[model samples]
Every structure is written in structure tokens, then in C-alpha cells.
Target: MRTASWGRQAGGYAAVVTVAETAGLTWEKDDRPLRGVPGAVRRDHGDLVKELRDLVKRVGVQLGTLTRALEGGFTVDTVHPYGWWRAELAGHPLARAVVRRLIWEIEVTPGQWRPVLPEAEHLPDAPDDALVRLWHPIRSDPGTVRAWRDLLTERRIQQAFREIYLLTPAEEDTRVHSNRFGHLVHHRRMFALFRARGWASGLLGPWDGSDEDEAVRTLAAGAWQVRFFHARADWAGDHELATTGQVRFARRLEGTWREVPLAEVPPLVFSEAMRDVDLFVGVTSIAADPDWTDRGPERAYWELAGFAELTESAEARREALQRILPRLEIANRCSLDGRFVVVRGDLATYKIHIGSADILMEPDNAYLCIVPSRRKSDGQVFLPFEDDRLSLILSKAFLLASDTKITDESILTRIKRGA
Candidate 1:
């Protein structure tokens, strides 16, 4: 890190810690006082293990924070009067880890982007006034996106977060309010997830206007914003209910914010905004609850959500499957349908929904129940990115593809019962 940033990071951390004990701030790689401990003191196994585990967890959290910032292009100061992107970084080891691995795109002119490798010489070559933002996949054509995906795959560079194949909803989407994410979500967990993603929201209660909350984030610098709305449902003790509302976009116009039509929102901003909402909903929704299907009225909601149209992440899964299926052992038995990966096994020809990871077998689209496993990958295949649902989909495809060798009684009965 440069000398200037080094001082700022240290002094800032000290002040924040001095002010509030509850403030959620963490130490940097070099700033941890634990580094000053003597080698002999650190030799104690239990103490060292506990401290190392805590440090790792904190650092992981900090890295996740920076990854989201970089992915969302928050580092690009789009509001700069000179229109020069300020992508400078220092102080945080987490920042160094992420920016080093990323391949950026510099906008030399309007609608023209040149891929910028992480080299000092190439970075400085761009003119001072050129706008620089993270090269979002949605900004490019399908061919370009596909090429980049292949490039990353060939390099085997693991991204700190989903990058080239990041879930980007269709550019032409015009939904003013999305009920697609609507359902009961755990109240505390929902807000916590939103906060981690840099969304600012308010409390929702039974009162008039206070009954709804919108988690919002600025996109495309300060020019645009996306709001994910939710309404208070009911709460009892620690269990509270909230239903998702509308996803609306707005623009900063003439010193005041004005609502913008979804079609008019810039493609990159729209994609980024929708992606955040998807993450929030995907993690906190009751539909992701494995037992939600066993509930009463909520069962209908689970069914709808589980069978809902392809999410951006699921869309990524579909593309990955497209590239992976032809190379699999059961290539002939598997085919990528629009939203379902059709896998034919001797016991049953199954259809796995790319969006929800739900399964259906042949003779009828009979739902073949299988939940996502705790282990994301079985370590059998090379995955260019991390996605649990994608892993589940692939695992099921492989298992069913060689169905005659299956020994799991539960799976066998499900196949035989044909439900």
C-alpha cells in the first residue's frame, strides 16, 4: 500500500474502535496486534488455533465485503467531475487479493470497451478522462460474454465472486415491480444479508407508511438506484414475516430523484441491481427452506418459487451445463432444454429445473424430490465458479445418468414410485 493510504487506514481504524465497541470494524492484515506476539507465546496449540480461526473468519468476511464492492463497481467514482475513474487501491490486503485477479474493461469511448489486464503499464496507458467501470457481462453482447467466460475457464482463475458469468437478467426487462421474489422471508436474516450487500433499508411495522421497507443501492455511480421493497407481514417472538414488494428504479434528475421506467434504466445498472435482489431473495426466502413444502398455504408459494422461471444464477447454470454436458460420460443421455436439463437414465429420464434445482421424471413431469446437499462440490469435476445449486444439478445428472449402479435406497424408491 502507498504511504498515504497506509496512514489513513490505520488512523481510521483506531478512531472507529475508540468511538464504539459495538462498531463492526476489523483489523487489517498488518494492523493486527496479534502479529506482535512472540513466537514462543504463539506456540501454544489451543490459543494459536482459536486465534487463527477467528482471524480467518474475520478476514474472509472482510474479503467478501470488498468482493461485493468491486463486483458492484463501487470503486469506480463515476461522479468525478473530470469523468476519470479512480480505481486506486491500498491499505486492505483483501482489496489487493481481489483487484489483482480481476480483468477489467476500460471505456476508451462511449460504448467502446477495451479489456485491461492487471498490469501497471497497461493501466496507466488509458487517457485520464476515460470512464472505467468493472466489465459487467451484461454490458457486452452474447458472443463477447461467451468468449470471456471461456477465457476465464481456460485460465482456471478462481474469482472471489461470480464475475464474467455473474447472473445478469435480460437487458430488455421492463418489470416496474417484481413479485417474483415475494414470499415470507426471515426478518432478521433478510436485513443482515442486505446490509452485507451494501443495501440501506428501514424498519417495517404495522404503522401506516412504516409498514414497508426498501433496501436500496446506487448503481452506475450516483446516477441511478434500484430499490427492493418489502412489506411487514406478521411477527411473533423471534420469528417475523415480511413479503417482498416491488423492485423499482430511479434517476437523479435536476438535483432531485425521479422514478425511471425499467426499460429506460441502463442495462448494466439494471443487471447489477437485479442481481443484488436475487441474492437477497435466494438466501432468505422460505422457498429455499427444504421443509416449506410440508407446510400449509405456504406450500403453494414453495411450489411456485421452486418452479419459477430461470434466475440469473440459474441462467448461468444453464450456460455452464451447455458447455459441460457434451463432455460428460452420459453425453448422449443428457440434453439442455430451455429451463430444464433433461437427463435420461435407465431407471428414469429426469428433468432438473435449472432455476430451482427441482426435478421431474418422464411418463409425466412427476416431481422427483431432491434437496441441495451441504457439500457444494463432490470434487469430481472442474467448476469454473462456485454455485451450490449448479453443483447439485450436475451431481444429480451424473448419478441418474448411471442409474443402474445406484445403491441409495431412498433415491431408488423415489424412482420406482414415479412421484
Candidate 2:
């Protein structure tokens, strides 16, 4: 079993709310800044606004820690005492709000866990000494998990983080990735992504730092480690380009860390760690750059990377699309083919790779490059969850579906021209 952590250290809601109310300020969900203040008020209350902003920022940062804790399996320290839970989690305003956003499990008997929705009933309604902990999809059966996903959808509940629909493919245990990421990614972007995902690595260079480095992240309270290998590509003699290699897992035996075959790692720990790596690769990979649709000499590399088999992240997107497509206004125009979302557009029939979000138009497999942007797509549909790539894919589909209506020259030029 993976080690357990309970997120009690999080500065609960903190004093930000109290200060906001004192200052006559308002806030939106996710601690977004106080919005919609009048012009005169904005000018006169500048100090108050700045102070509120700083406080909100602090709260967001603290909540970020709690989010990571939950991802790593945060349980209450009071394990088996229902009254203890009431005092620690249910009694407080902030804690109660946090508890409502997540699923909790009650262990009715030893070795048997039943996931309960916090909003469904009086959560952990068993005897005072009943065992309870935060529920994770990795700890539940697939059918049950799927049912929860459906419940979230039907109820239109937005999760603090992905709970259901999180991909934990048990079959992918033995076959880890090798020579995974390709192309030139600026070290700034790469390093920032690594830091954001809680991964660390040494410098990459010819001198001082080694030409190769292994970016590693410890998971499961130091029970496991994931190492992602990469070397300087030196394609243009620039150390900025990284040629990535194998992603391996290891176990911490006694006090020494030793590399272990992925099969030896527990499934939950493996899945949790892999999700971090997948997110890093998904966001930072050159395949994400829509402008790189036509790199003459590297066309093959680009195509292979873009059209490759779906990772767990892409699998989750596929699962979401299965539910979302029917609700889309362009429902008749879109359908999911293997590894691609096929959309029939006025300009051409297009295939968008679900994994890399690369697009290929039908006439001659022409490139239809649509970069990710904050611009809203031509629809007002409720999404059960949020994924940047999913939004980008849907936005691109909407654009292609209404190709003739697209007035933007950049997009029209790409649609009319071929690579």
C-alpha cells in the first residue's frame, strides 16, 4: 500500500474572507479577485484592492498545497472516529466546503471500502468508530468509477481536481515509455513545466552539467520514484533542445533507492506518477505547437509524434468527448474515430489527433493549424470537467465546422492553402 497523508496543515480559507468582508470586497470561485467594483470605488479603494489581492494570492497558494496533498491521498488523521471527523472536517466552514467538493469513503469492514459522495448523504454516517478516508478513483473498481463519472456529469458538479475520469490503466504497468519526447523545447519552458509538476533535474549542457540528466519525482511518500531521462539534442549545437529517453520507476528498499521494473511498483503509485509525466509531456512537447505543422525535414518526426498512440491523458479526453459530443451544437459534424476526432467541415473533412491535438485536412491530408487560445468557441455547452487540450480540440472543431463563417485571415489562409 502507498503511504498516507492527511492535509490538515493547509491554512483553511485563512483570514482572506474575513478581510474581504471587512473591506466590502467580493470574490468569485477559485479565489478569483474581487470583481465588478464601481469605478470611483476602484480608484478610492486601491490599497484595499491590492491588500485583498495579496491575501487571495496567499490563499490560492495554500489551497494548491492541499490539492497536491489530495492527489497524493490525503486522509484525516482521525481515521476511525466519526465524531472526530465531524470536529476536524465537518465542523469548520472552510473544511466543510472542501469536504463537499470531494468523495469520501467509509470502510464498513476491514479490507472493504465503499466510496460515498459527500453531497449524496450524511457522509460517513456509520458508528462513531467507523473508518473513513478521502476516496480516489485509483482505489475503486472501474465500473464503480465510471458510475461516479456519470453521476458527476448528470449532477453537473465541477470537481476541485479530476476525481472520476482519471485514467489509471492497469495494463500499462510493464511497458513504460522510452525515447518519448522529441524536438526543440526551450529549457525555460521545460524547466518551468518540470517545476510545476513537482519534478526536478540537474542542468543540461556540454560542460559543468552533464549532457544527459534524469528528471525525477518521488511519489507515495517516498515509496516510489519516477525518472525521466533526457539528453541535449545539439541539433543546432544549442543545448536548449532536449532529446528525451526512457521513463522508469523505482522502489525505495529499506533506506536505499533502487531502480525497479515498473511491474514491481504498485498500480496507484505508478498511475499517479505517470499522470504527472504525461501532463508535463502533453503541455511542453513540440507537438503542441500548431505552427510546426510543416517542418520540411522533420515532417516525419512531427507526424509520428502527433499521431502516436493515446496516453492516459488522451484516454481521459476520449472518455469526456464520448459524453460531451452529443451536447455540442455541431454534434452532427463531429464523430470519434480511432485516435482521432473526425469533423466534417465546409472546407474539408478534418481529423484531429486526440493525443497531440494535431489536425489533418482530408483532400490531401493538408494541415489545418489552430493554436490554443483563450477565445471562446461558438457554443455555450456545460463541460463536466476542464482540460486545456480538450478545450483547444473542441474550439478547433467548432472553427472547422463553420469554416465558411471564419473571417480570420490566418485561419482562412491555412484552410484554403495546403502544406
lDDT of each: 0.63, 0.66
Estimate the lDDT of model 1: 0.63
Q: Model 1, stretches more than 4 Å misplaced?
A: 1-55, 74-96, 107-112, 117-132, 160-188, 202-211, 219-223, 233-241, 252-256, 327-333, 372-379, 402-408
On a 0 to 1 TM-score scale, where does candidate 1 land against the true structure? 0.70
Q: Best by TM-score, which number?
A: 2
Going through the candidates in order, what is the number of backbone clashes in each?
Answer: 0, 0
Best by lDDT: 2
Location of the lowest summed lDDT over 10 successive residues in candidate 2: 1-10
lDDT of 2 by residue, 55-154 (tens): 6567556555655665666322224366677677655444455455567777788878777776556655677777777776776678877788777666
Which regions in candidate 2 have their CA more than 4 angstroms from the true location? 1-35, 74-82, 160-186, 236-239, 293-298, 377-379
Each prediction's TM-score versus the true structure: 0.70, 0.81
Clashing residue pairs, backbone N/CA/C < 3 A, model 1: none
Task: Give the Cα RMSD of candidate 1.
Answer: 8.6
